[model samples]
Target chain A: MLGGARSGKSRYAQARAEAIAGRHTLVATAEARDAEMRDRIARHRADRDQRWRTVEAPRDLAAAIDAANGADAVALVDCLTIWISNLMLAEADIDAATRDLCEAIQRFEGQLILVANEVGLGIVPDNALARRFRDEAGRANQAVAAAAQEVQMIFAGLPQRLK
Target chain B: MLGGARSGKSRYAQARAEAIAGRHTLVATAEARDAEMRDRIARHRADRDQRWRTVEAPRDLAAAIDAANGADAVALVDCLTIWISNLMLAEADIDAATRDLCEAIQRFEGQLILVANEVGLGIVPDNALARRFRDEAGRANQAVAAAAQEVQMIFAGLPQRLK
Candidate 1:
């Protein structure tokens, strides 16, 4: 799943995951840092209710996914963009992270829904840092989408099936 | 702005945009391809209220931005990732789209909050297409981040000021 802000990508991915398996595991890539964000997290948590087990992993997503894959749980990676940003600031190698994630996806046995942002359709950025981020994000989406059985683009809260 | 699924990135960005400017314009990058997605879009529309003008633009973001720019309206680009994907699939030269977006950004004089995904932190994709998308996304993020005056990362619905 991928799309613009508030494009319903997350909700769509979550529904798909829930439909696939009873034991749903949501591997979150976000870390709460403020009061506003806390509220948002709470809302999301509430929306999922008790049916989904949420794991907060700002880093080390591969390990987290592997741990969740032990059971017959359907793993849903809700957003890879944030994970990438976290890794960049943490000084982790982007290439290494991508490689690890792909490997984990290949090894996992249960159903998976990997959600991400498709961010490459805009203008070229002015500075080197911005350009670098854009390039990495583009690569990440491609990798995940390729691995995914179905690729979807959500716009205005609508999902367009891509692959 | 960027974050994981249900990470509050969109709300944070929306609030920021509302607080900073008067007349608001939302440049959407989703294509609305499913029933679930339609509901998602409706939710977002309700969230935004009737104060802002919405533009349905799945491609040619530079032109959309150009049309949205004016003295009374501030452009809020809710995302860049989907736009990139659309370009990658539709346009022959993705780099040209990047260049056009950047150029438009440079010329725009109003308040613009451009959201994008950071995609380089995950494991390297196994296939060539995935690898290429990751690389392109990274480049795009870096470019936009460098160009923008401020950059923020959202995690677990919490935002970290990174600029």
Candidate 2:
């Protein structure tokens, strides 16, 4: 699933995972490194109950997915852009990390849904890092959407399939 | 029409304006205050022929439209958010300006197509000015969309009618 902020992509992903018969796990890539982000994470946690087994994976996303998935498990990676940011902040290789993550996604046997933001729909960022991040995010979305059997974009809280 | 940066909203608007049988008037709200912006305006000028009579309305959009509209005219307002930004920079009353613009739109005699960016579908800006601008843009879009006879959203270079 792909959407802009507050477009209900996370909610839609959670709902889809819950509909499937399996152990539901939410692989959160957001790091509460700032006060505002911590509040956002807290709100997200308050929205879901113990029904979701949550894993914090600001990095090492593939490993988290590998560990969380099982025959009867359905894991949802809550977002990809944050993970990209984490990788950039950590000086990790973006292409290599994206490759590893995609491989893990392809290798995983359990049902999975990935959430990413559609960030390319706005103005060109005025700074270099923002522009690079936007480009990287667009590339990541294309790679994931191509590999996945299904792709959807959320607009105004409504879901529209793109693939 | 509403879309992201480089999403062809301007091109689409220009094309729509060209297709209509009337005196084509482009009410551009952009101010070429910078070199990059000047280049952009130049490129836009090159794209259209002498058929388009351009009006540069960085602010006072209502007056621009009221003056541009004619019995044999079709006016295309290239965007609203930039006008909003201009209004903000000039310390213009946003609500009053919006009200006046809507009134002018309602009273226009020519065929009209308005373009605006879908700026609300992104992460909340961390700064107060950006946040306020986003809110104002959203309000402006809603007001314009409500008054218009038709509305459409563009994604991935495709158009979807919303009303």
Candidate 3:
């Protein structure tokens, strides 16, 4: 699912993941690097409850998803943008990481729903890094969307299936 | 209609205005105070042909709308957030201005399409002024949406009617 910040993409994805009558795993990409982000992570954790087995993977998302694969299990990757950021911060090859992640999603023996933020809808960021991040996020979304069988966009707490 | 910045809200509004087989007047609220803004304004102006009689109204939107009112005219206010910002920077009474704007829309005889940016979707801003602006923008959107006969949200160039 694609959406802007606070557009209910995470909550809606959680609901969809919970509906599947099988093992559920949430691959969380956000790190509690700051107070505000910690608060957000805490709130999301509380919302998921014990039903979702959580995997903390700020990087190595493909490995995390590969490890969580199970028969009849459904894995929900909470977001991709943060993962991209983590890769960038660690000086990892973004193109390689994205490719591996897509491969993992395709090879996993269960359903997968990935969430990503649409950050390109605003004015171009003033700094070079932010602008590059925006461009990378857009490219990552296109790649994943092409690999997925269904794509959806969330707006104002409502879901619009695009494919 | 409302949307995120660069989400094509202005472009969509301009296309809609062009299609109206009547007098079309575009109320522009952005001032070209900087080089970047000047370029953006130039591009927008280039996209709009001579058919669109432009009214530059950084403030006093109600008066501009009242002036542009015509029997067979469709007046499109390119944006509302910029007007709100103008009001704030000038220390004008936001509530009073909003009321007057809504009253103008209610009293206008011609079709009106007002565009606004969704500014509350991101993380809580670090500063009080930005937070205040976000709150004010949200309140303005709600007030105008309540008065509008039809409300739409533009997402990735797709228009989704909300009301």
- Estimate, for each residue in B1-163, the C-alpha lDDT of model 3 and write its tens digit: 9886555678778888777888899999999988867987898899888888889999899999999998787999978988888888989998988999999999988789999988786667777888788888889999999989999886545567899
Candidate 1, residues A118-137, lDDT tens digits: the string is: 66654566666667877888
What are the per-residue Cα lDDT tens digits for candidate 2 across A63-161?
Answer: 998998688889999889898888888989888888888888888888999999888766667778888888888898898888898998765445678
Where does model 1 exceed 4 Å of error? Answer: B1-163
Count of clashes, each model: 69, 0, 1
Local accuracy of candidate 2 as per-residue lDDT tens digits, B67-154: 9878788999978989999999998999999999999989988788999887765544659788778767766776787678777778
Residue A18 of model 2 has an lDDT of 83
**For model 1, how big is the CA root-mean-square deviation?**
18.3
Candidate 3 off by > 4 Å: A4-115, A120-151, A155-158
lDDT of every predicted structure (CA atoms): 0.75, 0.84, 0.85
Model 3 chain A weakest lDDT span, ten residues long: A119-128
Interface RMSD of each: 12.6, 4.5, 4.5
Best by TM-score: 3
Ten residues in sequence with the least summed lDDT for candidate 3 chain B? B152-161
